[model samples]
Target: MCVWILIGLCIITKVHGYSDGDFPQSCDSLLPEHRRSGVNILPQNTKPPYKVTYKPGNNGEPITVSLESNPGHKFSGFMLEARETQRVDEGPPVGRFISLQPDTRLLTCSLSADSAVSNRYSAGKTLIRVNWTAEGAELDITFRATFVESYAKFWERVDRKVTIQTTTPPPTTQPSTAEPSTAKPSTANPSTVKPSTAKPSTAELSTTNSSPVTTSISSSTTQNTQRPDALGLKREGTVQMSLDILFVGVKMELPNIITITITNSLFSRGLIKVSNILCSLLSMAVEISAPILFCANDSCTVTLIALMCVVIVINFMDLVIVSLPIGPSHELKDICDLAAKVCSVIHMVFTIAALFVAVLEIDDCRNNRKDFWLLKVMTAFTVWICLFLIWTFVVSIHRNEILGRNKTGSSKWREQGKKNKLSAAEVIVTAVSVILIMGTLSFTVTVIAGIFLAKQTCA
Candidate 1:
């Protein structure tokens, strides 16, 4: 902290105010040429509190320009000048201020003397009145100013566009459609300048113009990858997907819940130690991989959120293993198992559908191919899910065949005709069937919804 204070003080010592109307460096941007870090151009706030009050002047007539701020707002310094309306963004202000207040003086720009008018002292003042004489050559002209509330704060490009009528008026062939003589930069944006101070939302206290966070509204959107102009853009949907990883814990797999209940329920389960562990590991790895996109940036929140989600899923899986009953007499468990499996089907169907929509939404751009590896990942996961359905069915059939052939060695309860529990094959079949049906429905709903949203957005 002490070191930082010293650094700030050292920089401050060299940062003298541009008091003597010596800010020709700000000719283009209209911002004070401090060029130090931590200052920036913010977006418009509310309506501008300053206004321009003027009357149309004919050729050779000296025009009065009044610059006033709203009550309670005083600017310590300002630079005011007029430019041709056609070159508003680029033209230079030249010798327009013929008479100026003693507190304000004329600025000799790079090419022209008395090219602009500015406050001569760094004292807070509310109003500046000056006389501008048109040098016989006349067209439309506008008055713009950069007002400094203080050395450290100011608003640039506060302008009011008005038509200064030339002395020898041309034939008024058509009715003047020009707006009222009064002009404010833009009614839509106050000051028509970056304002609201927004000192708080400072592009991470931006020494530059960009202030968007990792998952900001701008970064989360997926843009057209096919545009050659987007070659340098971040991978498509990467930011949005990273944000989605935080929900993995809440989206715990349904099959894992059933697997935990099988050995302790009416379902006579087979060994699932291998496949069960592999499935959970695979899914968790996929969720974890999502954070790799964030590695390029310094946003630790993405990594932390992803890890937190992973922890939640692991805890839920553990809870399922620890809580279920150890016998086949869980009548409630039977009903719950069936219902949960049905819900699982519905969930997977939606999952599959969502994955498909994700694939469809991928930006088809050659340059973004490497960044868009997420699409390939979605396809691989889909294939694996389909394989899980087929593998479970095939294993269950094989298990049933083996069990039927060994009927002679069946449990005493089965031998005595008291068998009522569901077999491994039955359990597996129910789980697989529920998944297939629900997954299909999920896909259909996703595609239809995507289509509807696309139409709405395009329209």
Candidate 2:
């Protein structure tokens, strides 16, 4: 009895002792039978960044993975790493990884059996963390090997996945007339389609134009890609005339019209100035790349990467300055910082555009297969821009709230409470900035990989 009890205790301890290292670390380490799988990790708190659904190979069916944002938090996007498990004695390693941000919550990925993804190793234990700076809230979900497989199957049965389908109505057929036609229709095919005689939708005819616009929206859609021209340029004169009439009528409201015109002029001028600054900065990046432009193909590639790093540094500085806590009475400093933040955002946008151009201008890239490194950088930048937009909103909201509350002349304790909340908001901003910097650094590494590849070719 004593021996049996000791053995039972040993078994229990072994079962509970499984650690992160025990899990498959790469796609290659995953069981051959379990290829194309997902492991769901439930969030520790509410508002998880994303919910994952892994559908392991279903009888001979392709493996599938689905992701959705949890309630109270929207899914922004994700970066996935798929590494090939290295043998203990292997000389070197190679693998594939990709980042994607599908807008929909019900994003699905189908992994084919023949795809190389099956050969890549799993990312070992994974974590999904979501931070909502506005609400000063965060949630973390960790996936462990011991529970992933079981949880995935469990969620499959509990969560029903639904797909939406849209159907277009069938075209109406004209009824055959009993009376004989006076003249038979031409046998030759018409070069152009006859315009529909039906009146346009009220929405389509309601477009306005007198506001310094380039074109009038005279159709239901702004543009129809399915059409031959793809611009929806075949608008009827009647529709155009209706829009003109409405726009002219608006202009007749003299005071409102004058105010709108002034606003438009100011906005347009501000946009022009911003654009000019961005263009100049981009030109400077190109000039920096010029010294090594012709030394070697590899040198040119390096130059492009260096330019990207410079922009990243500039943006990082801007982020740091913007993140500095504003004193309670520092309104001027706050306004200036806000303006600087806007300019920094525009600078980053132009910088990203410049990097794209630099990549495209690469001689090797033109002929060689597209590099995943560049794609990763692009994805990172796209995600950063989205986050920046949200961060701006959060900052604006917190600033307004704090200022509004301070105006109320609250008690000392209440003021302190507001200050605490403001501090939390600042912490969130700093955290987001750090995240952006980390992402940018990762992207830089990816760019370096391409540069190294170019160097290899030159060798």
Which number leads on lDDT?
1
Count residue pairs with overlapping backbones in model 1.
14
Q: Tell me how candidate 1 scores on lDDT.
A: 0.49
Per-prediction backbone clash count:
14, 9
Please provide, for model 1 over 45-162, each residue's C-alpha lDDT reduced to its tens digit, 9 standing for 90 to 100: 5566677766444334566688899999988777778888888789877445753333566676657766687765555677777667667665677788877776566777788787
Once fitted onto the true fold, the runs of candidate 1 whose alpha carbons sit more than 4 angstroms away are 1-20, 34-44, 169-459
Per-residue accuracy of model 2 over 311-407 as CA lDDT, tens digit each: 5465445445444555435766657555655645554554555445444333222223344355455556557656655655465557445323344
Q: Report each candidate's C-alpha RMSD, comma-separated, in the order given.
A: 23.7, 26.7
With candidate 2 superimposed using the best TM-score fit, by how many Å does residue 363's alpha carbon deviate from the native? 6.3
